[model samples]
Target: MATLILAQKATSLAYGPLVYAHYLQDHESDLTVTVEWQDVPEITVGGDKTNVVLRIGDIQVVGAANAVHELAIMSGHASQYTDVADQLPHWLDFTRNELASGDFKQLGQTFETLNRHLTLRSFLAGYTPTEADFAVWGALRANKIFGGNMKSGGAKLGPHLVRWFTYLNGLPCVAEALKGHQRAVESTRNRVDQGNFDIPLKDGALGKVVTRFPPEPSGYLHIGHAKAALLNQYFAQKYDGQLILRFDDTNPSKEKMEFEQSIVEDLRLLGVAADRTTHTSDYFDQLYQYALQLIEDGLAYVDDTDNATMREERGAGIASRRRDETVAENQRRFEEMTRGTDYGLTCCLRAKMSVDNPNKAMRDPVVYRCNVKDPHHIHGYKWKVYPTYDFACPVVDSLEGVTHALRTNEYRDRNPQYEWFFDALKIRPVHIWDFSRLNFVYTLLSKRKLQQLVDEGLVNGWDDPRFPTVRGIRRRGLTIEALKQYILMQGASQNILLLEWDKLWALNKKVIDPVAPRHTAITEQNLCVVNVLDCPALPEARDVPKHKKNPAVGIKKLYTSNTLCLEAEDAAELAVDEEITLMDWGNMIVKRVQRDPATNIVTQVDLALHLDGDVKKTKKKLTWLSMLTPAEEPGLVQCMLVDYDHLLTKKKLEEGDQWQDYVNPVTEFKTRALGDSNLHDLRQGDIIQLERRGYYICDRPSTTESPMVYLIRVPDGKAKSTAAKVNAPPNA
Candidate 1:
């Protein structure tokens, strides 16, 4: 390998050769040339500013007049360094030029496109440093340094690329380069770190608020956890307080590195990257000291009673024999327990709270447990003892300077205990914010249940669309904006409620409908044959918007023919001479209706133009497809027109009732359909509202060329009140 050395300032100029080499290699050209180092210009511009010159190696090159000042070395046979100022470079330069010119509109779009392709975690060459990574990083920082209207454009540059960008940006190395770039920093801020924290200053002065998102990495985070993360994050950002992401991985048995990593990823995905991401394990020594201080202060003790006996003793409002153990004995046993020498035979650490407290969690809960097994995930058999999450959480929060502690209402009872730990340890007080947990119907968010489903193959995995996992929802075409908006709508409330699926799906639709592309399909209808009056072979119709608002979203132009087909139901009641409106076109007349004699069902329909000049009045205009010019061949879609009467048949099921008996037989209906060519191009996970057919997502792509499988639903169909329909205004 030879070297092409350029000065540090000329690094940008070196980009051309490397890219050209790669491009040539891609084309299977093995042409090799050695580039030796020499003095070069700091910045090189477009060709035509230099003169012919030859160097010591007889390399044919041109030297520009006054180019020495500009570092332009040219060759007589000099080929323009076309590679340097090409498409990718032009985009980069356009971004830079736009930033300089203050044309933010164009700059924002270009940067958004670049951001989609570049990310921090991405490896430069191949998961490691490469010239491309560094170059892209430099250009991206310009947007950050010189402010612009920054927002994610819902542009996805593939998962590997996404993960790469995320990882690179999160690295401690590039953090310095990202300084002064508020948008970039905010993008990386952790969700749970937002909170109102008040630190106490000197002379009885109150300081600003700080908060932390402390997640126990024993299971995957659900929407409830996501809500807490976002609330804390919002508060932190609002208050300008430090947000910390701490892993309360105290119990090693259930916790794993996998969960820890996923918790970090989940937080990042939710736009929650705290000011600092620290772990409880990182402060084990301090936590241990705190525990010892509580024991020494006579505020905690070692309980040697077995689990069943201890529960019985606490429930009876009686202190166990171990509770009465002297401080010296308790301290000795705690040490022994920590060593795992007398673990099972010895005692566990418990905060000495009231036995008669109504809340079971307050009744001297155990703060530490001993286990001789290998470390579960991170520690990996390194320690024989672990602190409980409840015990470690407050300690770490205070130690990390966290001001506000936020969690779901489920922990309301334990809030006092959290306070007790701080009081007993003589630590600073942290404010607590309680909010309701989110519950979605038809899905279980319990980790154990989800794990069972995964283990038993009831669902695919964590990312299974059938499951309510974050990745699952994302894969199902739900956007981060939608998730944030939905959670915000739920608001922070003390009142706990079981959220209806209808409301959640409605919110989801609201976000996705405005921008998702529109394609046409119908259930129970195999083809749409549009009848035209000597229709042109190729009719050019502009793409129709999925949404009337939002012009940035793209649409498709559907072609029509003389024998366009409409849904069976749409054709069912059509009478001769009746007028029906075509969606994109004007009115058409129902010339005739054909029915199958054996089945006695509407089999087909014939139609003629119900031109506005002739038709005076009409009702129920419907959509149709032209059979003469089918963009996509017939029968390419397997449509499921899903209908759910209720999640449960009965209004409510008794505790012991056979609820499974109420499973709605007609919960879903599947049929075949002829879709446009554009519909055939829909990838799995694309959500589309079939015209008058309801909203749906493509669950699986078609194995054959023609038809795809679609899972769809009609909003508010089952829930719509008949009374409301009867009383509705005429137009509606």
Candidate 2:
């Protein structure tokens, strides 16, 4: 082991090596790098302005361009620094030459390049955080300080770039560098300290870390929405910050008070309480005023560009003729849009960002749309024009004093556009954190597609057990604890993978399997009647624990009688004169078997109660139901057991695939069964498990038209097999 020396400034010039040094220092407990240091020379012998230089024994390197590059190459090869040393070179050249240019246009292009690179990644160069990220991020940070245009956060920076930049800056070491060691003085602006469980922030918000989870109340929330909610909840709790549940209900065409109220109920059911529930509708007047300010400042104009042609022009990088509309003319047309007249519907307010930017999102996107079909969910028909999500989100987030905005990476393209609004409105800028969108394979989580299933009568409704909505999964017997555990386990990762459903259901089993009460039900069709020749004349009832492994869960009753019932399938397997064990009862010997004359289906069986025989000797242990006559108290109840298959045939549906062609031919199946008397007391929405069958949720309790309890089969871990035609293979 030999000494390695670093002689560099803590300034932006040496920020690349500085960030990497900080990362190396953070992981010092896990690493072994002998090091030494020296002060920076007054001036470089060479013309290079780079601040960092390193020396390891015989090897010497100068400037960040060479020092950072050689640090990666030689450290891994000869000095044994870290594996990241090898890959840092690839990113250094790009950062030093391309990213460090400090040119506004090059910065935009650089942001676009970085945005595409970080689409589904957490780091710049590898699966784990590496020096490459620090090198590149350092250059970006330096640009932010020296480059005034970048500091203002215009439409030039892409969303993913901003997201990654924000995430890196949140790192403990990076944060220390950002805020400096000022004990008595601090900038009025906040440092963006928000991210995963591992990302550390100082003393929680108290009241400083204000955050919000904005949901558009157009449909019921699905599992994907749960991810967004839970992540926001995680950070809010992590920093002791306030989480506001703001309904982004700006579109009058889709939003309804019914949806608004349902969303409230759903969030409550999820066990997440917002510090306060607010709505984008709350800021309609303020947003309207902001729009006027944009026009008056020549940053926005009214465009009558047809929908199709506007898209074509955007793709072609062609400017709209309305781009040059005078401020007076634009405001006049905007006033018409607010009136909801025929011409108003055709006119839209567009931002004046760019018409030929390579990024299509910056190509003068629409800011407002006109509609007056129905009263707003909160405002009623008092106003006609509505701000687009792009315009409202950034504006309201800043207006509400939101310190950090958690956005799904799906909005990565329009990030620059969002910042443009924040700048044009001249409000406090909120930090943007983009996490990957949640996606599950073989499941449809889209509210729009789910709505189609409801409208087309393909599914029961939004709360149908087969659907992936929160209400649907709960209806299917998934516990809220299990749902939360499953989602949070995914962590704050940025990787977007199509997850399998088993992982989620498996978590549910951990929660429900322990506490869910146990009951009994025998198939109604082809039930076998057995005669216990030497049993007590009268039926005997005894109390039995619901869960054998968890006795504290309480108990249910079991009855034994001379005549009992068994599943026809179980009886068919029994041989005449062969002794078998009746679960909960002693061994019984099969004396005779009776069958239908034509079909040969087991119809009846005669057995002798051999109480002395060892139950362990029997290979066949059966779940039997004692015959309860119509005269028995709290009598047996007939019930329907239902199970379902995936809605789509493919494991992962591609964008080009037709939904109609992939719809499962048969998704639901039902069977009739006779449940124990105790089951009669079970009500709808109760989760229980049958002795020989699987877990179930009581979908419907006894009613005049439907007397039997309806038990919807809830999946354990494996996919259930159905006898009906299935698009997926058996057991899928």
Count of clashes in candidate 1: 53
Best by TM-score: 2
For model 2, how does the per-residue alpha-carbon lDDT over 606-721 read when each residue is reduced to its tens digit? Answer: 99988899998999888888885335567778888888877887778887987778888788777888888888788888888898798898899987687889898878876453
Model 2: CA > 4 A from native: 1-196, 200-206, 629-632, 703-705, 719-732
Provide the TM-score for each candidate, comma-separated. Answer: 0.62, 0.71
Superposed by TM-score, candidate 1 places the C-alpha of residue 33 at a distance from the truth, in angstroms, of 95
Task: Report the C-alpha lDDT of model 1 over 1-732, residue by residue, as the tens digit.
Answer: 222332222323332232323333333233333333334334232453221222334333332111111121221111233343233344334423553444556655554555554554344334443334434444443334222222342243334444554554554435432232234335333222232233322222133667787777877777777888888777777676777888877777677778878878878888887888888899878888888888888878987788898888888888877776778987888888777885544667898887889888899888888888757566676667678888988888788877777788888989989999888888887788777788654446667767776786655577765556676666555667767777776666666766655555666777667666655655444332335544465644445665556667666656665656677677677787877787766787777677778865677666676566333355675766654444444433444443223323444444586644543333323455666656656677777766665566676666576454655443422245101222232210
Worst 10 residues of 1 by lDDT: 64-73
User: What TM-score does candidate 2 reach?
Assistant: 0.71
- Candidate 2 lDDT trough over 10 residues, lowest sum: 184-193
Give candidates' CA RMSD values in order: 23.2, 19.6
lDDT of 2: 0.77
